[model samples]
Target: MTIASTLRLSLYGVALSAISTLGLIGCSNSSTDTAATTENSSAADAEKPAKSIAITQIVEHPSLDDMRRGIIDELADNGYVEGQNLTVNFQSAQGNTATAGQIAKQFAGDNPDAIVAISTPSAQSIVAATTTIPIIYTAVSDPLGAKLINEDGKPFQSNLTGLSSQLPLEPQLDLLQQIKPEMKTIGYVYSPGEANSVSLRDSLKQALPARDLTLLDIPANRPTDIGMATRSLQGRADIIYTSFDNNVASAFEAMTQAANELKLPIVASDEFSVKRGAAAALGVNDYDFGRTTGKMVYRVLNGEAINNIEPAVMNDLTLYISPKHAKTQGVSLPAELLKNGINVDEQAQSTDNK
Candidate 1:
């Protein structure tokens, strides 16, 4: 063996060993950095607490149902998705006020970020349940009467704020008058048990006389009574008018059935009622009201004080008319109304069937 060749072979082996050592060190440093990054990311995610909210509704009618769905959708759009960073718990009272009270108690105990009350009854119940948990209410016709807010629609102390479904009486009455210019008597079917309905009924008494229209008040104590109360208006009331009374809304189909049989047209304060055989509806979309309520909730969950957020009312009025329904109820909508209003041509199904 030659000495020079032996030396060359030994140097090559040493060089190879040095390269392998550097490669191993580079791999160790890369792995450590990647693992640290992953750990820090996990810790950050863990630090973010999961937010939750509870929602309650007086009944499961289409208006309230759409409101609830809109709230959920609004939250989802704002990144507080259900089954993710936010937890949404919803319950319906099934048209029972007592059951509403019970559900409010349950939700109050849970102590979520906010409680969304759909109707006046549920709003009153939840407000009674907790003074601390933020209460965001919607579909309430009169927040003042419900005591959810004080003067000028500001939160009445405690954790309370909401959007009101207070009907724009002038526009609604105008729609009815347009439908029947000779409507001397307007019959209303409402539930006295609900504070909003009673508020609306009282308001009607004052507003109708100014317009030269007399109001025939038909008070329905229960869902079953809605049909009978409506039938009683026959031969007296020139047309049937309905507000967003939970009980009356629960059996709205029955009332519409009797109205149709009596050949009486209906003017409603809920957009959903047009789909339930009302001749026309002039009111705010409850779903939009729910979404607005959700925005209020988002502000609350983000740490804004409840009272700091002033209560809002549904402003934009949408008119809906069903030609088929109007004809069935012995009235024909005006040509301008057919052109201006949202024309719903689909046949109306009963509340029970829907």
Candidate 2:
């Protein structure tokens, strides 16, 4: 009786052991399948290439820097994150035309997915360097004037598109008149090599005469030459006016210093310069301008045809005035000017003589 009961119990134990072994084997196969699926999924993800963008600018000024920042941030927000799924290679020309030209060639050689040129000179250089690389330019006041656009009023077929910050000269000129009603001559400081500045200079030449004002052309080849260029206008011109010249704006503190010493008022076409110490500034918002260009870059990178994208023109205007600078520059601010002004206190604080 004991042998029979013991055999039954032993057989029952063996059955339970077999069931447990089968369950373990089934669980092992399930786990292995799950790990293999995960590995395959990760491998597929790794096969995807990260988007690449290269940004080149004429100089490292606040406005241009703001534009760069806006582009990078907007790209990240849209989906192309730096070091994550996107790569951004940024280079600054440091206010040198030759250097800008060199940078453009280098970028052309590397041949990134897309190129962003920040200013007029930068855009022109890149344009001359490559015809196949997709390009987006910002802060260029007049793309048409710069010859970046074709006769048909569009970006060259498929290669280029960007934002043009072409501001109206009338408001800026009228504002100058309001500041100095007796202003007979305007000292124009700019770099002739820059297409944007040259366009602005030509505009001023035509507009100033109609307003009974004279244009005194003062050329600055580089940022270091701005102080002298500005000082030269002191006695020859009644008031100083500046174009959105990258060189002049990069060395704007020097321009402000010379104007302060000469007791001459300066009104700038670039609103960034006003925040940097010009008595008044009226132009496009540089940061937003960059963001706009960035969205276009996203489109080109996402397989959208570049030619289909229309070149952007920024007609929005912003006015910035520093009361302290206005008084120092011997400029009287009109009530209407103040009402439309955007106080850039932080930018002004950085512009102090330091």
Candidate 3:
């Protein structure tokens, strides 16, 4: 009677053990299936392409416009069409710093892939607006001085890189001497708010003494002040020097008019300034500056780290001469310089009838 009861209990225990083992196997299979489904979903998400990038520019001036065009052109060439794989948002500050800052903030709000700043102010504003969005700046002079980068010209703990329009000042100053050997006092006009302009002014002042020239500072805080500043320098300066100040550039016509009235020849940092009224200017082409900026944007947009990219400088600079202004101011350029001039012929023809 004891053996029969013991065998029945053992059989019941074996049946329970088998049932538990099958239940464990079923649970394991279900868990494995769930994991496989999750892995497949994750792989699908990983294969989906990322969203298109949004790019913003600070202002809309001739130089900045050229830069924007260059960027779009490059993007198109790379198959990142504006409406397709890329979304470009271009806004202009119209020379207003506050407006630029607002635009920067707005661009950052949209979480753009990158921001393209055209000038120093724009770049600074963009940098102030965001610490993460990549920035590509063009036509900025002395990014270090502008506080847009570290002294090494590297990104300052953020994603920022671009080109600097710091053309060699030596050649420009030498041209001044060539055009007006007796020019003792050269009047220079710049905007104080511009770090690049301030830095350039210091360089010019320090270099002028060695050339036996005195740099007369004509400070114009805004575009409207340019006319008065140019008038103030009428008789005080034998020649006028201009920097790539946005304020001054915006009112170059007024300054050039005053200089022409005073028979004061002008030398500028941009060829377009020379075309307006300056006697001569040595500068890189704005279009090319824009093109180089575009290449930087391409690199950054194509997955390269902005911090790892180095700032670029234009390789070629052209000498531009205004024959009309030259004749009016009684200045003559070297024959070689005239031959290589970018806008001499048109200037001469326009002046011939005048």
- All candidates' lDDT scores? 0.79, 0.76, 0.71
> In model 3, how large is the Cα lDDT of residue 171?
71
- Residue range 39-62, candidate 3, lDDT tens digits: 654454333334345444444546
Show the lowest summed lDDT stretch of 10 residues, model 2.
21-30
List the RMSD of every prediction in angstroms. 21.6, 21.9, 24.2
TM-score ranking from best to worst? Answer: 1, 2, 3
Comparing candidate 1 with candidate 3, which one achieves the higher TM-score? 1
Off by over 4 Å in 3: 1-59, 347-354
lDDT leader: 1
* lDDT, residue 195, candidate 2: 81
The residue-by-residue lDDT of candidate 1 on 240-276, one tens digit each, is 8888888988898999999999999999876789888
Q: Where does candidate 2 stray beyond 4 Å? A: 1-49, 346-354
Clashing pairs in 2: none
What residue runs in model 1 are displaced by over 4 Å at the alpha carbon? Answer: 1-48, 346-354
Q: What lDDT score is found at residue 290 in candidate 3?
A: 68
In terms of lDDT, model 2 sits at 0.76
Pairs that clash in candidate 1: none
